[model samples]
Target: MLEQGRLGTRQLTTLTFMMVVGDMMLIYPSVITSYAKQDSWICAFIGVPLGMALMAMILKLCSMHPEKNLVQMARSILGFWPGTFFSCFYLFFFIIGASTHTREVGDFMTTQIFQYTPIRIIILMFVIVIGWGVWHGLETMGRSSELLMPVVIVFIVVLAVCLLPQVDTSNLKPVSDTGVVSISQGILVSIIYPIGEVVPIMMILPYAAKQAHQTRDMLIAAGLGSLILATLVTISLLVLGAFLTQHNIYASFVLSQKISIGSFFERIEAIMASSWMISTYFKAMIYLYAFIVGCAELFKLKQYRMLVLPASILVFGLANLVSPSITFIVITVVPYWVDWDTTLGIILPGCLLLIQWLKSYRKSSVTPNNSQQ
Candidate 1:
């Protein structure tokens, strides 16, 4: 069984919320709106049901083995060889996710703040800091996310509210002009990135305070987070319009630039930058911690700290190698995310659920009396 004092259901829920809105509030609006157009908000809006379904599947798997993390539960349900192999696959995914998030932090900082700084230096700094946070363990990660979440939310809300004067409704005009199929396709594209990314959360579910309400809290967190994401997406659309925002790489940052209150309240991009930085750092730490723990579990290590430094090196190196340019990063990550994540978040969970049902049926057929257990 996983150790006690992992994380409470509420904390896990909070983590989920922060995960969705944190770093994502920076890039998602621009990319999603790029495809979905004036109706891009509609894309995220449609994601509500899909996101809930994904969360439901994940939570059900967690519920099956209340005390086991995804790696452990995979072992129990699939037997030794298959489970071990799949666990390694998950570990790779976690490591890659850590690297990708590190890239995000570096790209944002270098582009917006330190234009001349090398990406390697920025990535290394975060990797070391995140390595330290992960070494502190999950409780510290949870508390830090909880403390940062409110400040992040307030910053976002202020930006959204301030954009009220600049909004242009006509920018969102001609809804569904691209036809139902196009809009639907765009929605599917948009949903794949954010909602499907939740697959990584399965690793953390066993840490939830109460197994009984794991699904409940997962849904709650997914809901609250999606609501926040969709709201911000909508606000971005209303504030900047679809055309201009589609061209701007950091739509949220540009929107932040537009927030000026009668000449006194200007240059608020710094606040948004600060908020996004906190979220980005937290995201990097969370994924790295999961990767470290997963490695420890896989190798049967006594403690996870041993791998933290080496893993940080690997993650920083990979982040540096990811993209030559931000545009290249965008071109690559968009489609790759949709395809791979569909397999991970949607297909993988569905397969697990179906296999569990089949096992239950077979056991019932073999020994109806003892099968009750």
Candidate 2:
């Protein structure tokens, strides 16, 4: 192994939970609403099992390989040069993923809360903190997640519960009005995101203390995360309605403002925002960590910590250059990013798995023939 850090069962579970919720809280409602209209919540409910299926596939693939990560496993299955090419492509995915995630944090900060701050300044601040987290290593990040995840869950639950009274049942009237194709599209969008993005976690899973139960831990976390997003999307549709949720870029945040229990329990959007940022931090930091560690593995470097500074600088630069404004991310990057995640997370691993199975089967048959002869 190129890195030396371990994750407890709790740390792994919490980290997975946070990764699923991450930035989805910011943009998913509008994106899914645009796809399924009023049927968006239905897509959320359907995604739980389907999303876990995808997660289970990834986990099964990882467990079969034991200590090997995506990079090493690919190299072993494919020839060195071919695998290197594939791994290089994955590295590109990780860095770009990190950059775009960083860009989102900057974009969100400027547009919503820190209106006066320059985008680069906001990105730079996050890059510093995120880079600092990656600087420590996976165990450090895992421990931090264990501590912070509870607060995030509480905020998300509170946001949903507090906004229930405002939910208009009629907003969801004419449900299934979008028809099957549109609902499928919406469900696909919901799954490919957050769940698809969980691919990067494979790089760190080798560091987990117990491999036997990672699948269960991941499934539970993913299911919980899926349901939580479902609740948020459902409530967003019911409270803000399909029209408002589709139009509102920050539907979750705006939904937070809708809380009104005697006025004293209102204006707690900050609490919700904090949870989103924390999850985003974990997501982006994990990507960057994978990039750094992947680079170390690629170059045969002794440790990944040395690359942290340069990688952080690269992320900061790319984040600014990736898009001119938040609209580009919402309009252009958001949709395509899902495809990117699916390709890297699902398709690539599935291919590698099939190849491995064939090779094992062939080897088994050859051994029987040789023994009989």
Which candidate number would show the highest TM-score if scored against the true structure? 2
Report the number of clashing residue pairs per model: 0, 0
lDDT of 1 by residue, 1-373 (tens): 3333478766787778766665687888877777778898888888877787777877777777877776887788899789888788778877888898888888888999999998888998889899888878777788888788888889888988888888778888888776777677667755566666766677777776664666677787787777777887888888878887778778889888888898999998988888888877876677777788777787777777788889999998889887777878788876577677777777877787888889989987889666665
Assess each prediction's global lDDT (C-alpha) against the native: 0.79, 0.88
TM-score of model 2 vs. true structure: 0.98
In candidate 1, position 48 carries an lDDT of: 75
lDDT of 2 by residue, 332-370 (tens): 877787678778877998898888889989999999999
What ranges in model 1 sit over 4 Å off? 1-4, 211-214, 369-373
Q: lDDT (0-100) at residue 112 of candidate 1? A: 90
The reply for model 2, stretches above 4 Å from the true place, is: none
lDDT of 1 at 50: 78
Candidate No. with top lDDT: 2
